[model samples]
Target chain A: MFFKFKNKKITNMISIVPNNIIKFEDEAGQYNFPIKRTLKMMDIMGYKEHRLFNDSVILSDVAVYGLNYMFENNIINKEDIDALLFVSNCTDHIIPPTSNIIQGKLGLKTDMICLDIMQACAGFVVGLLQSFMLLDSGSVNKVVLINGGTMKSRVSKKDRNSWPLIGESCSITVIENGGNNDVFASVYMDGVNSNALIIPAGGFRMPSSEETGKLQTLEDGNERALDHLTMEGVGVFNFVQTVVPEELKKLMDYAKIYDKDIFAYLFHQPNKFMLEKLADKMGMERSKMPSNVVENFGNSDSGTIPLVTTYNYGSLFEQEEKTVCFSGFGAGLTCASIIMNFGKLENCKLIEYGKNR
Target chain B: MREKILEILQDLRPELDFTESNDFIEDGYLDSFDMVALVSNLDKTFCISILGEDIIPENFANLEAIENIVKKYK
Candidate 1:
């Protein structure tokens, strides 16, 4: 006997208006290497007309900025948001939960449902899937999904590998109930090589403490407890090489679509090298692989994929009938892939708020 | 100096057919990060600290512009 999951129609599909994105440049006008400068950059970027701000180095700034941006654009009223989804690897406040902080900052409804998802890089994808499910369930009409990261704060400043490979960013995508067939399909990773990448400290198994803090080293030295990110590069490469292709194949199989059907493939902007390698392995063109933001933002944890989509929105979705594939992979050693179709909208307009001169 | 700048830019973006006349940023050949990194590497190679104000888009717009700036300091 075979069990089949019924395909539900997503009406009035969730799509971003004013898809052209404005980047939050660092105050010192530098790249990702300088963490202090980068944090300051967020504050400067926030002060601009854009809706988001980076008040503190904490990850919640992403949600705060998103809410602020939405309000500024008159996209949604504070009381109108029905559900809140906060996706991040770093949440400064442990007790009340990060989503609560976001709700407090945004002055959202007290009755609003809030939850925090700690899925590292794949957090955005998980949040997207969860928001879709919630919207499809008819329980919530509008959901705010925030994807933010501050991996730089967690890494030792002197650690070259982590220092160069990690960066910070936050973005929010608001999903609303619109009956449309545009949302399309999704695929997730099955349990295999779950521990390919991780942070060895500050979790339930190895809780953060003074002693653990002292033992942490920012370099590739003997001290393992500096609360830094750890990854088996080769191990992750192997798993990504194996599972991502399988996930892509499965998504294609389930959607009954071919490689040429999709307009663009927006995978997590891992790095230039990894992206090129993955493109080669997946039998996809380098152009189809939309981005590798490592040069500017480094690996922005969960924010990378969305950032790419936001940046490349014009070129990727120029055609009326277009399909874009979004895939994210990171710490749970998790991966989530979704294929979305885009259609012309009459109400959507691009907003350019920043100063060119 | 022009040839050297061209060499550095070529190294940064091996895909781009860069010349002394090509505008790095406006031509979509180099981004903000690439410009910063290029300045840092150039400063190291020539042993000069480039002020933030001096590193404008116009100066690094092409190989000739970068060479002119470098020659002024040298």
Candidate 2:
């Protein structure tokens, strides 16, 4: 199962594997509560803090820390990186793309290929797949894939169910072609559920405008403007509860692996309760499930899955563990998972990126 | 005033020991978000508005620095 690009040779291509994974969050940064507080503080400073989810300082902090940590550990040199793939719907600014900003900040070569993928929750996996394809095509040797987002403060405070739940995070994974025997990946999306969770304003379909801002309320009393994140909680829950498990089972079967063979199930950290419910439905032991960092960090959009992976790498990659599953589903009504067989954990270093800038 | 700020720091982030002159950001005690929240609480508690520019790293470096800002504004 290989994808070939026209006019591109696949031979002598390097295999992209997860060499090092790093997850970062601000030391004392809490989720929506702190975001709300920050907004209120901004209000006090006379800057109307509208579009709460537009730019996430916390997520950026985590990302910068992770990148710096990788640099510090010498996993991938700034000069050695051939391209950067940043997957996130939440960006630091509206223009110039977040990839450029990250490239500049990380002191990577200016000529390095920089691109941003605005996929919602399934971003990190999408990033991984994209980087893998790039590696397989011989287009790039070493690529840094960063998946993160700040969706906590984006949810409308008016919506009680989602307001207190969203978490923010940023994580980075360095994938270089290697000697591991990890199972390949598959990704799928449900366009029908796209509207189930979205920021109604601030995009090509519906650009931000005063008129659109006025039509802010949905039938469920959720805001439809860019001011906050709007989610149909029950709708999203039903979708995830139904789609994710089915997809995971399908992927596992396709890979000729059984549920019991899966060493650990790393899914998106939406919330503690929801994840446990999904784990229960899949007939997997709660102990096999990874810890939900969202309790403190909130739902960090694309960063959730990688953050979970980074946090649980120790237990999953024990002495000679061979198989683990990574899954993430969110915004785009998207779900993605891949079974990876980590051959040896001794060679890889788990870098702890601290937040400095 | 310094002791009061220390009390608040200890309350917010119990992980750190709030000494009289601890550099919050440098020592890994607090972050940008924490600093923002701390300033908000300080303003409400002491009835003062902290300017955005005033919320720089130097001003929020320690208990003494926070107390000075609060007292000056108060």
lDDT of 2 at A132: 74
TM-score of chain A of 1: 0.77
lDDT of 1 by residue, A87-112 (tens): 78678666778888888877888877
Model 2, residue A300: distance off in Å is: 0.7
Q: Which ten residues in a row have the lowest lDDT in candidate 2 chain A?
A: A8-17
Give the alpha carbon lDDT tens digit for every residue of A70-162 in model 2: 566554578888878879887776788788888887788876788888887788777877877777767688777777766654565454345
> B31-65, model 1: which lDDT tens digit per residue?
55466557666876887655444556788887778
Model 1 local distance difference test score:
0.60
The model with the greatest TM-score is: 1
